[model samples]
Target: MTRIEQTFITLKQQNKKALIPYIMAGDPNPSVTVDLMHKLVAHGADIIEVGLPFSDPMADGQVIATAGERALAGGTSTRQAIEMVKQFRQTDQNTPVLVMGYLNPIEIIGYENFANLCSEAGVDGILMVDLPPNEADDFPKKLQHYTPCPMNQIFLLSPTTAFDRRQSVIDNASGFIYYVSVKGVTGSNALDTDDVSTHLKAIKANTDIPVCVGFGIRDGVSAKALSAVADGVIVGSELVRHFGDDSIDTKTAIDNILAKMDELRRAIDG
Candidate 1:
């Protein structure tokens, strides 16, 4: 089984749901990225979704957009993002780290070469927000060229997705499928629990793999409500908000983030 699959299985055995958090790789500063990753695992994150800091992140809101701008201004590159994962793997061999971003960078590096580099760097999964399954016809085949495919090519599904399109994504997606709870960008308004539950029911009916819900999930209450219905919750803007405060140091930011994560961890486990 993939590391992500094993992580979910282990969580299922414990009667606990996964709490996956997202952060831009070089936000605040590139030097602190690996340390922040360790802190996430230390707190309670089951999987860490690290953003690749693209020039334009269409799916992200202002908070994340600002974080990406900070990262880029600090000279963060795709290679450095992979190296962060390599450094993270030094002490952590189990926690799954999924790199998320747009497709332009992947194409620039050449997909096969990028896969090889990720394999060498010990990355566990990747989520290209803009690369729908239709355009990624050969993505998995290319990834297989590596002796042992080092990453799961995760895909996104939204509330408006038709049944057939949902089925298409579920069939093609590995690791777990990311369900965008809201129809908009990250860090939007409050989530409607009843509406999300209905969507979760439909998605779970179609796929055996874990389905993680993201977008508009902000606090422990919302996290708990969603976790009760879905296999996991991927929180981005709420966590990224802490990192954007220039008034605080990176360690202070991470400590605060972990405290928030602790709340989420408790909520999901409850």
Candidate 2:
């Protein structure tokens, strides 16, 4: 099985909800970006989502969009992000690394080359927000030319999703289904756990593939709530806010997030 698939299996076996922490590559600088990754993994980041910078990220909110802008301004490129993955692969070939970003940068690098690089760099999956499942046959075909093993192309589903559409998306969803808890960006609001649970439970009952809920997940309480219904939880703005705070101890920030997520993770399965 692919690593992404294996990760879910392991998570299921352990009765633990995955803690996915997102980091925009080369934000601030490559070294810090790299350091932050290691720290996150050391803490409790079950899966690492490395975002590639794009000029215009429509699916993103102000935090992530601004993060992409900053990374791009700092010379972060599609190629550079892949290189960071390579660096990360040097030590961590086991933890699944997923590249999440816009399609324009991937187009610039060429799909096959980018996919090949990711496979070579030990990336386990891809999550292009703009790419829909209906047109994924082309990408799935083109992506075949590259990875050493199969690479899962993950997709997202929102609450407004209809049964037929959700079924189709779930049918096509590999690795895992990124179920958005709310209709907005990754952060900027408090997640209504009841709504998240109702949505995730329905999706879970419909498919065998694992479901991971994201957006507006800030603390362990939120993660714990989502965990009761979903297999995992993704945190984005919670992590990005750390990058902007120059005064807060980054180690502290990392620990705080770790503690919060860990608390929720434990509460779910404990």
For all candidates, the clash counts are 0, 0
User: Which digits, one per residue and each the tens of the lDDT, describe model 1 over residues 2-121?
Assistant: 678789899999988899999998998899899889988989999999999888899999999999999999999998998999899889989998899888998999887888888788
TM-score of each: 0.96, 0.91
Candidate 2 ranges beyond 4 A from true positions: 141-146, 246-270
Name the 10 consecutive residues with the lowest summed lDDT in model 2.
140-149
Residue 166 in model 1: shift from native, Å? Answer: 1.0
Give each model's whole-structure lDDT.
0.87, 0.79
The alpha-carbon lDDT assigned to residue 192 of candidate 1 equals: 82
The candidate maximizing lDDT is 1
For model 1, the stretches where C-alpha displacement exceeds 4 angstroms are 141-145
lDDT tens digits, residue span 74-150, model 2: 89988889789888878887888889987887887887777888888778889998888886776754453455756
| Model 2 pairs whose backbones collide | none
